[model samples]
Target chain A: MKLLELQAACAAYGQSQVLWSIDMEVEQGAAVALIGRNGVGKTTLLNAIAGVQKLTGGHLKFGGEDLTATPAHGRARAGIGFVPQGRHVFPHLTVMENLTVGLAALAGRKAVKESGIASHIFDLFPKLTQIKNRKAGLLSGGEQQQLAIGRALAGQPRLLLLDEPTEGIQPNVVQQIEAALRRIRTELGVTILIVEQYLDFAWSFAEAYHVMQRGRIIRSGSTAMESASEISHLVNI
Target chain B: MHESAFLIGQVFNGISVASLFVMAALGLALSFGLMRVINMAHGEMLMLGGYLAYLTLLVVPGPLGILVAMPVAFLGAAFLGGILELTVIHRLSTRPLDTLLATWGVSLILQQAARNLFGAIGVQVVAPTWLDHTISFSTGILSGLTLPDTRLFILLVAALILGGVALLINKTRLGLYVRAVNQDRPTAAALGVNARLVDLTVFALGTGVAGLAGVILALLGPVTPTVGQSYIVPAFLVVILGGLGSLVGTTIASLMVGLFTALIEIYVDVSVAQVLLLVFVILFIQIRPQGVIAVRSRALEG
Candidate 1:
């Protein structure tokens, strides 16, 4: 069954339509890659799905519930975690504080206590635990990315939406992120929907791939079957 | 010997005045520090709180009135803050400059309304009998120094409120969410922090604290329709000089401003002292554009 589905989703910013009837789906525990070149509405699509941006038309269903009209906070409450591009971590807050911010959003104090989400997030990113007291602004790019992902995981999201997780990141740190994503998928059973301009890094973790161009999906295939040349040709890398 | 005694008396008077300024400025610091909203009408909010305290005394007689007025003024200002957030502030959330203008307009309207209802003349606020006395300490060379019980009460209240606000921001869950939103609003929202709601609550909390300051102001002296205007510049200076959104920075700045202003008033003419303070603050800003404590770097990133 589809854990998340976007049926002919149309979105816009102000007057210009940025996404044109975009359709996509991700099954439970599946790692789906959204591969697209710059300005192909990848970020807009992610924003729309996360309810940060309004949809011009069509519907969004998460865990079989229609989420088209839901506000961004409501979407988050309904378990849609988003890691926006540029790893926007709270600079004023320490790493632990950033993680606790997400934990505070649990349905109630009881839910937070039951989840032990902070500990689990720290366990996933051990580096975060070491520098948990350090302010997020003081961290390096790689550390910020880990804190960003850890913060999202603290919400215990059913479906995680990551936009350009590897963009501008060092290659070594990219490997660490891949390892973290693998752990999230294998250990926590968190489903991920990632938008990527970097095909090589994305294909390593994603089980399926969707290629978008000019605000619409041009191709879709299993990651195991698609060749590197095919991805390059689709994205024109 | 007599000149020394008079000088000491002037010093005590300055300390009292400084304490009041600190109270007024702390709330402004909290609001500007977290939201980056200038809240030009912050002084008016403080005046409204003072008026509320005055009104509370008229309605409820005796010491109980003073006790009730404190929380009432706070909650009342908080309610006003929440309303402003929904009607005006929410609209201007993305427009910082517009918020300044809008709140300034609100301030004018509130001041005129107060003048119409309460009259332009200052209303005398009666302190409880226990606060009307003076406390004195005597030493060999300095002789005895005297302080008003009311001023001491204000100082203690200011200290308590500041401590409470610090605890609320640092230790509590709500504080955690506020810090998160302040640090990175969009990211906080993505993490399910409910940024909008948090903004509203923070604004309300800051306004409520301002109202409490108002109640304390009323206790300190006569509360006129234009009383808030007197506090506006000092509060802004405290907030800006302390840094944009650092509460601790604001508190320290407030104390410094309070003491500095007090000392200046004693040695220099009051008007000249005011000008000097402004000039000093202007120079200080040039030196540290980010204020005494800069906000975390990520907070400034788009």
Candidate 2:
């Protein structure tokens, strides 16, 4: 079952067009990677699909439902979770408060009560429990990333978009994050779309890969050994 | 009376004045601090609230009229504020200067409309019997300490409004949405929060609270069409000096400004005191531009 499909999509930030008639697809329960060097439209494409950026042309569908015109909030309500780059956590709010912010989407006022969803997040990142009362800003980089992902999952999303989750994270925590994401994909059956710059990370985790360059996916293939080297060679290291 | 007694009396006077400023500044902070709009028409909303109180008197025409006026003025001003937010402010949310100029124009237009409707002459607002006396102390070292009944009323109203606002923002379910909007608008919306609706509600709540302030002000003296003009600057100062997006900061700043102005006016001319206070605020801003409390959020940092 196709979960997301983008056909000939075009997008721009003011005068600079960042995505040019890009075509992409993600099947249900599939772990897909969008890999590219810096300055490519990898993040921009994800933003368009997330409904944060409006596409200039073409169509986007999620769960066989048209989502080209849906606004970001509506898309969120429809169960597309996004953990944007830079771990944009609410710094002033407490850890518990930050988790509750994700529950805001389920229902206004009524869903605001403390619920069991938080315990699941605690299970995923148990460190959040000890410092639940502390402000989220004071958390370490890895903990903040976990909180960001945990916060997104609190919305009970059917699909997740993670952009550079391991950008500045330490190696041990990076392994832990990958393990958590794998659990989210296989155990929870949530569709995963990750944007990454590291060849080893993307190739190992994602079942298939899309290689982007200068606002276009120049080549794509299964995560085979020959294709992985070929994709890596296509870019200047 | 001893010098200490005189000082205590002036301190009390300053606190009462600060109470009034807090009532006015709460709305100013809500509009400027949260929405990021320099709503120059805020004074006009205050004036409109005064007019609503006057209209309430005409309809009820007794002690009962004062009772009817408070909620009517608050709701009326809130409704008007919501309309203005929808029609003008929302369109210019990103353009602070343009929003400021447009609201200034609105202030002028509203003042003109009020003058045309109620005439240029000031309209008298009658205070009830409960508000007609002063609580005075004339014994021991505290001889000649006098607190006006009206000032006491202002204090009560301020306490009630501040308490109500604190509860609404801190404890209620709507407060969650408000805080989310304040903290990270993009993330909030992406998490399925209706950010626009939250903006409209916060704007209306601030304007409505300002209307409550006007009701308290109306009983003090003549309710003129330009009554709001006198307080808007002080209210802005309170918000700025207190800091952006901190209610506690606004409260502390209000008391500071009120005390500073009152104490200075005792030793110097009122106009001289004003100039000195401005200089002090300028120096303070130069030292710490974020005011008493700097906000820590993704929006502020980025």
Candidate 3:
């Protein structure tokens, strides 16, 4: 089943027209990679799906419900979790506090045991447990990324949107994140749509790939059939 | 009175005044820290609270009338503040200067409306019998000093409000949302926090606190239309001295302003003391541009 679908979606940043009419779809529980070069509207597309960027002319359907008019917060409550490009975490808040903030989406819904979420997140990112009490601003880049992803997962969204999650991280932490992403998809049954620059990382996780160029999807194919070098050449060109 | 007694009396007066400053400045700091906009009409919320308390006392005339008036004022001012935010502040949210000017216009319109409804002279809210007593020293060096029960009541009420607000910001779920949005609006909204709701809540809550301060201010003076104006300037100074809307910073700044005013009044005239307070604030900001508690944020403007 199609968990997410965008039809002729168009977005603009104050008349600059960043995303032209674009169509896309993601199946339930599928890991899809949106790969493109810099300034290719990948982040903008992610933002439009996350409801942060206002769609100029388009319809977004999530789980078969038309979400074009839904605001960003409404989209979040409706099982769309967004981890932005910069990993914008509340710096002054402790790691625990930041995680608790994600639980805000659960308001007006069935009560879920917070301890369950906490233990699951801690199990995935064990390093978070050791520095749970420390302020988020004091954390390293990789640690902040972990906290950002963990914070989003606390809401237990069915669909997760990540923008450049592996950007500016050590290789060891990148591997840890990749492993966690694998579990988040397999164990929790989350559907992921990640915007990635690193071809190897994206190719390793995503089953299908969409290459965006000049505000349009120029190519789409199964990841297993395509070579990373060929795709990298297309993006770099 | 002895020299020590005189000093002690002045210090007590300073603390009493400081409590009022704390009440007035808290809302200003919190909302300013979050929205980066000042509600010039915030002073009018205090006036509205004082007016609401007066109206409440008319209906519930008894020893507990003042107590009943407290909640009435809070709700009344909070409701009005919420309306103002939706109608005025929200529309001009992106333009800080426009918001300030527009709210100032609102303050004027409200002042005119009050003068038309209640009269230009203003009304008085009588203190209950329970607050009529005074603590006096009949013997020793403090023989001439007297502590009025009304001021003590104000102090107690201020302390309760401070404690309540601190708990709300630090412990509650709403508070967590508030902190999250205050730190990062776009991110919080993306995370399912209704940033608009948080803004409205804080704006209303700030006005509500001002209303509480209004009730206590009525105890100190007549509930006049311009009563809020007298304190609003000092409250702005407190917000400027307090760092990035921090409660602790605002409280400390209030104490500093209150004590400085009271202590310097012993040496200079009231008008001169006001000038000195402004100078002190200017100097303080020159030394610490980020206010008392520096907030580390990723937002370039913040």
Candidate 4:
């Protein structure tokens, strides 16, 4: 089943069109990476999907339901969880509180115990459980990244959208995140649609890739490229 | 010995005054802290609340009526604030200066309305029986200390309110939504939190609390259309001194301003103390703009 589909989607900022006629699709439980150069519509597209920015023209469908006019919070309740760029964690709230915030979407769901959610999150990232009492702002960048993902997961989303998770983090932490994403995909079967710039980092786990340029998807296919060098050439100057 | 007793009595007076400052400042702090809007009509909200209290006295007599009027006033003011939010404040939310000017306009309109309705003169809320008398106290070292029953009652009431607000902000789900919106409205909205609804609710809550403060002030003196004018500046000073958007900072700052005003009044002119307090706040901000309990956030940064 198609988890998400964007049909001829277009968005603009005060006369300057950032995303125009973009078409994209992700199947249920699929791991898809969206890549493009700097200043492209990657972030805009993600924002549109997450309902942060309303599309001027397009049809958005998730889980076989229309979502074109839904607000951001409404999108979350419909099982669309977003982890925005720069790890926008609530600095004052504790690690546990940040995670519980994700539960805002799961309020009406049956038997969604808070403790059970914590345990589930801890089971995914044990490092979070260790410092769960600490303020989110005090955490290291990598820890914050984990908390961001963990917080998104706490929403119990069927589909997770991540924007530039490894933007400024160390290499070792990136590897940890990759491992976690893989586990999330295979074990939990949560559909993921990621916007990433790092080729090797994204290409490793992504089952498929889409290249966005000037607000349009120009290229998309199976992950089997000729070589990493070719993939690097495809991504950057 | 008598000098020492007078000093102690003055200190008690300061503490009593602090409670009123805390109560009066609470709503303004909440509105400014969460929404980042300078609500110039915040004082009007309090004035309206006082009028509500005075009106309540006509229907329900005595202290029991005062108790009932609190929730009633809160609801009425909240409803009025909600209307303003929808009509004016919400539209100008993105423009802080515009919001300030718009709310200031609203304040003027409210004051005129109050004057036309209640007249330029003020109405008095009859003091509750329990708070109508002064109480005398004496410790081993200090004798002949007297505390006004009104101040005592108000002090306890303000403390209870502070406790309630703290608990609500820290422990409740509504608080989670509030804090989330306060820190980052866009991110909170993206997380499926109703940021707009939260803003409206907070606006109402703040105005409701202001109504309660008006009722308390009415007990001390008459409720006039211009009563809020005298309060608006001091309440704003307390909010800013406490730190923008920091509830704990507001609480501590209100007490500090209250006590300092009381202390300085003993030795200096009341007007001089006001000027000095402004200078102190200016210096304090210059040194530590973040405040006593500022949260770590990059929400304002590019």
Candidate 5:
């Protein structure tokens, strides 16, 4: 079953239209990569999916439910989690506090405990447990990324959208994040959609690839089938 | 040199006044600290609590009147705060300066309404028989200064309220959500924190505390429609001096301002003392522009 679908999604920032007639989908438990160069509406696509930005004209559905009219908070409540670019963690909050903030959205403490989902986030990103007491702002870039992913996972989301998780991180941290994403897909069964500028880092983790240029997806195919030259040409690597 | 006995008396008076300021300033600080709103009308909310207490005294028996008025003032002011949140504050959340202006307008409207309904003159609030007495302790060199029971009661109540607020923010899950929202709105919203609900609840809670302060103020002395204006400046001073959004800083600042104002009123001219205090505050702000305790947030960088 399709976890998320965007039919001719169109969006804008005030007067400027950034996303034009975009269509995309992520099937259940599928790991999809949105690969594009800068200013190619990659982040804009994630924002639209997360309901943070309004669609000028389009249809957005999640698990077959029309989510076009849903607000960002309602989308969050409906299990669509977004890890925005720049790892926007609450700097003043402790790691535990950040996690707890997400946990508060659960129906009750009993449901939270019954799910054991928060522990799954911690298990995926073990560094979070050690730095639970430390403020998020003081964390390293990689730790902040982990914290950001961990925060989203705490919400027990069915569909997770990550925007440039390894954009500015070191190679070793990128590896850790890739491993965490694998575990998230295999163990927790989360449908993952990630936007990335780096083809090498993203191609190994994503099952399918969508190449966007100038606010439109120009190519879509299996990650294994796409040639390195084609990928380089698409992302201008 | 000031006489030891005189100094002791002044200290006692300062402590009592500080306790009162702490009551009023803590609520103002909490509201602004968490919400980043000046809530210029917070003082008026306090004044409303005082007026409610006064009105309650008219209907209830003397001793039980003040007791009954406390919760009523809290709920009344909380409801008003909630209404303001829905009507004005909710729209002005992103615009701090606009919120200050809008709430100030609300405060003016409330004050003028009070003036029309209750008359412009101050209405006296009588203390219950238990609080009417004074307690004195004896020392060898000089007799220890006496303190009013009502003042002592107010002090205890302030301590309790501050303690409760501290616990709520530091320990409770709701507080964790508030702190998260204060630190980063976008991140909190992404985490499913429902930033709007948290904002409304925090504003209402802060205003409720203000109402409690108002009730305590009513018990302290007379209340007038314009009474809120008097505390508005001091509340701002306390919030800024203590550090933005730091409860501990607010408590210490409240006591310091209270004691300083009381001492100045005693030894120096009240107006001159206020001027000196203002100068000191200005100097302090110049030294620590972020406040005694800074509001830590990534958004603050840009």
Candidate 6:
């Protein structure tokens, strides 16, 4: 079943239009990657999906429920967890406090207790447990990225949207994140839609890929059919 | 010995005044920190609290009347603040200058309303008999230093409130949401934090604190409509000097302003001390523009 769908999605930053009538769909429990060069409205599309960027014109649906008019927080409560680019972690808050913020998404919704969600997150990222009390700002790039993803997962989102999760991190931690994403999808059965500039990581993690350029999906296919080098070459990487 | 004792007394006065400033400035600081909108009418929350305390005491008269008035004033002011947030501040949140002007207008209207309701002359809240005595010092360098129980009570109440606020911000789930929202609104919202609800809660909470300040103010003097006006400026200074709406920053800034005002008044008149206080703030800002505690964030530098 399709867990997410976007029809004629259009978004703009002020008067400069970034996303133009983009249509996309992701099946439940599928890991999909959205790849594009800089300035190709990839991040904007993710923002639109996360409900942070308002769709100037479009219809968005999650789990067959219309979500076009839903605000960001509403989208979050409706099971859309967004790990935005740059890992916008709450700097002043401690690691545990940051994770606790994810529980806030489940205010009126049925969910596991705080400890239940937290221990799951810690199991996913053991590094977080050791430095749970440390302020998020003091964390390195990789740690912050992990925290951002863990923070989103703490909400127990059915659909997770990650934008460049592997950006500016150590290779070892990047592998760790990739491994976590695989488990998050295969074991946890969470649907994943990731926007990435890293072709290698995108190819390995996502079962399907959509290439976006100038706010529209230009090409999409199963990862089994097309190689990362081909898509990388086509997009002139 | 007398001189030293007088200095000690002024220090106590500074602490008392600091406590008042903390209550007045906290709400402004929190809301401003979160929304980046200055509430020009925040002073009215204090006024409302004072008036509410006056009215509550009328019905529940006794030594515990002031205690009863505290929560009444807090809730009343908080309700008014919530209304102000919904009606005016929320509408003008994006346009900060417009919010200022609108809230300024609201402040004027509230002042007028108070004037019409209770008269411009102001009403008094007599401190209970329990607060009537003073702790006196007689021999030593601190001799002649006299501390009133009312002032001590104010100090204790302020401390408790401050502790409560601190705990709320640091330890609670709500505080976690508040911190997240303060740092990144869009991101926090994306994480399913109802930013608007947080704003309403904080705005109301801040105003409630202001109301509590008002009740305390009434103990020191008359509960006039414009009473908040006198402290509003200093409260703004405290917020400015405190950084990015951080609680620690606000508390420290309040102490600095309160102590500076009190100590300066020793050598100069109240008016001159006020000028010196402004000058001190200017100089202080020049050195550390970020305020007492700097909050580092990846977004929203302003």
Q: Give the worst 10-residue stretch by lDDT in candidate 6 chain A.
A: A110-119
At residue B36, candidate 2 shows an lDDT of 86
How many clashes in each candidate? 1, 0, 0, 1, 0, 0
Better candidate by lDDT, 3 or 4: 3
Q: Model 6's DockQ?
A: 0.62
Tens-digit lDDT track for model 1 on B128-155? Answer: 8878898765665455667788888887
Candidate 1: CAPRI quality band: medium
Query: Which has the higher lDDT value, candidate number 1 or candidate number 5?
Result: 5
Error of 3 at A194 (Å): 0.9
lDDT of 6 by residue, B69-151 (tens): 99999999999999999999998877998998999999999999999999999999999999999999898888889999989
Local distance difference test scores for all models: 0.82, 0.84, 0.90, 0.84, 0.82, 0.91
Q: What are the runs in model 3 whose C-alpha is more than 4 Å off? A: A110-118, B297-302
User: What would you estimate as the lDDT of candidate 6?
Assistant: 0.91
Candidate 4, residues A1-237, lDDT tens digits: the string is 899999999999989999989888999989899998887889999999999988999899999999999999989888898999888988878888888788887755564544436566788888998998998878888999999999999888889999999889999988888888888888888999998888776777787898888888888876765344555665796
Candidate 2 ranges with C-alpha deviation above 4 Å: A108-116, A224-227, B297-302
- DockQ preference between candidates 5 and 6, better one: 6
Give candidate 1 misplaced runs (Cα > 4 Å): A108-114, B1-15, B296-302
Summing lDDT over every window of 10 consecutive residues in candidate 3 chain B, give the lowest-scoring window.
Answer: B293-302
Per-model TM values vs. the true structure: 0.92, 0.94, 0.97, 0.94, 0.93, 0.96
TM-score of 2: 0.94
Clashes of 4: 1
Q: What's the TM-score of candidate 5 when only chain A is evaluated?
A: 0.94
Which order, best to worst by lDDT? 6, 3, 4, 2, 5, 1
Superior by TM-score: candidate 1 or candidate 4: 4
Work out candidate 4's RMSD over C-alphas: 2.3
